[model samples]
Target chain A: MRLSSGDSIFYDLFTAAALNLRDGVRVLSEALAPDADRAALVPRLKDIEHAGDEHTHDIVRRVNSGAKTPFHRDDIYRLAGGIDDVLDDVEAALDLMVLYRIKEMPTGIAAVVDVLDRAADLTAEAMPRLRTANELTKYWIEINRLENEADQTYRRLLAHIFSGEYDALTVHKLKDVIEILESAVDGFERVANIVEQIALKQ
Target chain B: MRLSSGDSIFYDLFTAAALNLRDGVRVLSEALAPDADRAALVPRLKDIEHAGDEHTHDIVRRVNSGAKTPFHRDDIYRLAGGIDDVLDDVEAALDLMVLYRIKEMPTGIAAVVDVLDRAADLTAEAMPRLRTANELTKYWIEINRLENEADQTYRRLLAHIFSGEYDALTVHKLKDVIEILESAVDGFERVANIVEQIALKQ
Candidate 1:
């Protein structure tokens, strides 16, 4: 079960990707601020997403190139793909907000984003733990709990949007944004589940 | 490399799921018809979705029970999950349409759904081929092409919705429906890709 130096690099790449997600979530929070310049921030988040893709590609390339790894190759592919899914949803949420020129967001959005921010932190902290598969139960459990919180926040946010407060067009645009945010939170839970699966196999 | 009788059940389960998808899409098409009864059709599609979930759970149970599989266990997990994803999106699209009580769908919607219909048919046709891993390249290629077509139809549909033809509220509702349809098409592509990966590994 000994891993080569090459295998050790997997931990570094995963940690890099997780840390990048933390940065992406932080910028997303700023973009949601009342006075934030969304137009400019969109590109910044897009850049983070692009970086995330490279991280994913690097992981996949390692697996595809027939390198030996610590865990099942398919698990690596799924884990990398899961992380990319979260970043894609996060970037899309910001991009859509700008595309629809949506200015007024429901207050409940912050609750969901706060959960995502915490998930990002937890994911990043747990990446290195993949090497040992140690003390990882809490990470997945907390992510699942946060996802439940997000689901409630998302429901309230939708109710707020559909309360006939905003015009029809605004409701349409806001719903699009909120649904993607919910997907992003779900993506975190999906990633955590993959981590748990990989741990169990060990 | 020989499969046991228990292993053969996988093909039957997959074929059953794919055939069920065909039935689901046909009902969806019917529900989209101008003269059709969406209220009645919604329950039918819901039934189809529930059936799909059972198929997925059955496949997972077989794998968890340590039964031999025709392909890698993880690939089995992913393929089942991918198929379930498509059904969920398809059901969601139909459900949202009924929830919004949309009476006037754009002509372009039929084009998008048409692609989905075709993709579902192709997928259903390909499931049995998993046993021999034969003739699947065309299946995946056609699905990828159809997805591209779906993307174009979706963009045009969005443009038409935003073209000031309908009121703001109507645009919101139409966009929601169209987005889910697009996701369903993408889900098909994902399933196709997993099939391709499994085929290549074999």
Candidate 2:
């Protein structure tokens, strides 16, 4: 697939967004460490999230300027928005952790973060391939599988929270964080789904 | 602003999706009623959700077949998916109610449902204007305001639930349902957001 200059720019933006997502999820996983500095890590996650926002804005701006898009204009917008959403949820989870003053990290939180980090890595790797639609199926499939694992982990965490194991306040604090983590995973799946749809259309 | 034949089909799909959303939210609100038959309402909600899914699928299939879409292809896909997502969450909320066997409805539940019903109605009213992009600013703005109201209601409900007002199990059940209702509202905002983006690009 011969790429035009505008297509090259779109690919660059998508790649940048993916790398930002991967870095953001990595920070998120690290922040979940039991001994990690919650205060410091959150600001870094915010920077990554802001970068994601800029990338999404850039893509939308380019699309609006009537640049010749490599894929359907709508796919480019969705792909950019979808990638931004994953980062947004990542930032939200970290912010909630800080707001809730969660001290100890739950084992299940680490598990879900691990899945999200891998999904982020997969997404970053898959973004460039949007041009060629090459070998994208495995990326979307893996993301879907990771999301299912995250779902199961989320349910288990919910059950654990409500099993009289934690105080009401603790449950209240933990529930929002866990749900946002699950939403981040779901956001990744949405990005992968969009990629798959683009591939199928191609 | 004249729409071609193919454009009319896209409008019809969006309208149908919006109507399905309105009906699904209505049923969801009714199911939350204290005297309602939860089991029967579940299947009916399921049917509405299925209808939403089919409409979304139809839009995607049409887009895939190279039909001339009124908006950007990505916007159409996002709009259809966003509308379908609200119904999906509505169904999820009802299913959780049944799964958790929540016999009593909280007062806050009805308030959020009322907001969602209006949001859904607003969405149906806005879909036709995709052709002209007429008066959509008000639509998106109103949806955003409704979402903000829903957010305040959600936080208040959360505070009430965690104030030792309900048992831990009850809190667990209500939390998921309320969150999904909030999510449905957010989903509507997303649809409006996509519409606004499309209008801007025009």
Candidate 3:
């Protein structure tokens, strides 16, 4: 997809935001590892999230400056905001893990992180094509599917938590972490949905 | 604020959505009552949520038709989606209560519902001003503050739940309901944020 001169900056911003999301989720996956070091990994995750915030601010500044954007200015704003949301939730999940002083990851946390990793990868791959709105249908469809899978996983994990397998406190801690991870996956779906909306308009 | 012809439909849709959100949360509050009849209230809440879905669809249809919108079209879409999200989370919370066959509401559910009710009223009152962007700073600021309150309540509720006050199963069920209610409040905050963003851009 060939980008016009005016649209190139948006493409750059979106791509950077997507790559930042990928990095943030990678850190998240590491944080959910069985032997993960919360103290060490959390600061690194925060850095990635901070980087995502900077990219989001750049996109928002561009939109607010009344520049000629490739798509509707609001879509660009939403896309940036949605990507930032994914990173924010990633950071939140990691922070919760640290705050709760959870020594062990829940059984389903890894699966949720795996889905987020794929969603982030797909989002990065799909973002550059936003200039032309090309092949976005598959991107969004796959994202939607992954989100559904994440939802099921979330429900199953909740059931497991409540199934008398763990004490009330442990269940509480794990639930907090799982819900944040679920929100991150949902955040990715929101970005995909926004991209699909923009593509349809284009 | 007198609405221009091009903006009137949007105002109508936004007002209807805000009202629907109010109604949905009202029902949600009732559902959290100690002697509530889940069977009776769930259907009514679902009706209110369905009505919200209709209003949201109307907004999207209008935007998709390239009709002249009062604000940026993307803002309209996001505002509609954010409003619908509040109602959807309300409905989901109610559904979870029924599905979990929860006999008692959590301690903090009422507090969260009160905040949501106030937030909904503020949002409804603010929708008309969206045309002129009048008096909106207070609206979003108050909503943000309410969201903060909801967050504190959520944390406190979690602490209470995990403080060995309830059995594992009961805590799990209550936590699910509380989280969805929290999300509804957050959804309201998202709407307020979008409104603030639109107001600033204007």
Best by DockQ: 1
- Residues B44-162 of candidate 2: C-alpha lDDT, one tens digit per residue: 88788888889889899999889887778888878787787778888888877776567886887778988988998999999888778899999999999999999999999999999
User: Taking the candidates one at a time, how many backbone clashes does each contain?
Assistant: 0, 1, 0
CAPRI-style grade of the A/B interface in model 2: incorrect
Candidate 3 chain A least-lDDT 10 residues:
A1-10
Residue-level lDDT tens digits of model 2 in A1-202:
2344746788878898899889999998888999989899987998888888888898899899988887899989888888888888888888888888899867777789789878988998998888788889889889889998888788778767766677878878888898888898899999998999888878
**Which portions of model 3 miss their true places by more than 4 Å?**
A1-9, A35-78, B1-55, B67-86, B99-101, B106-202
Q: Name the best candidate (by TM-score).
A: 1
User: Residue by residue across B47-82, what tens digits does model 3's lDDT show?
Assistant: 887788889988898888889887888788888989
Clashing pairs in 3: none
Q: Per-residue lDDT tens digits of candidate 1, residues A1-202?
A: 2333868888888888888988888888888877789989988998998899899998998989998888899999998888888988888788777766677688778898799899999999999999898889989999999999999998899888888898777777788889998999999999999999999999
lDDT of each: 0.87, 0.85, 0.86
> What is model 1's C-alpha RMSD?
6.3
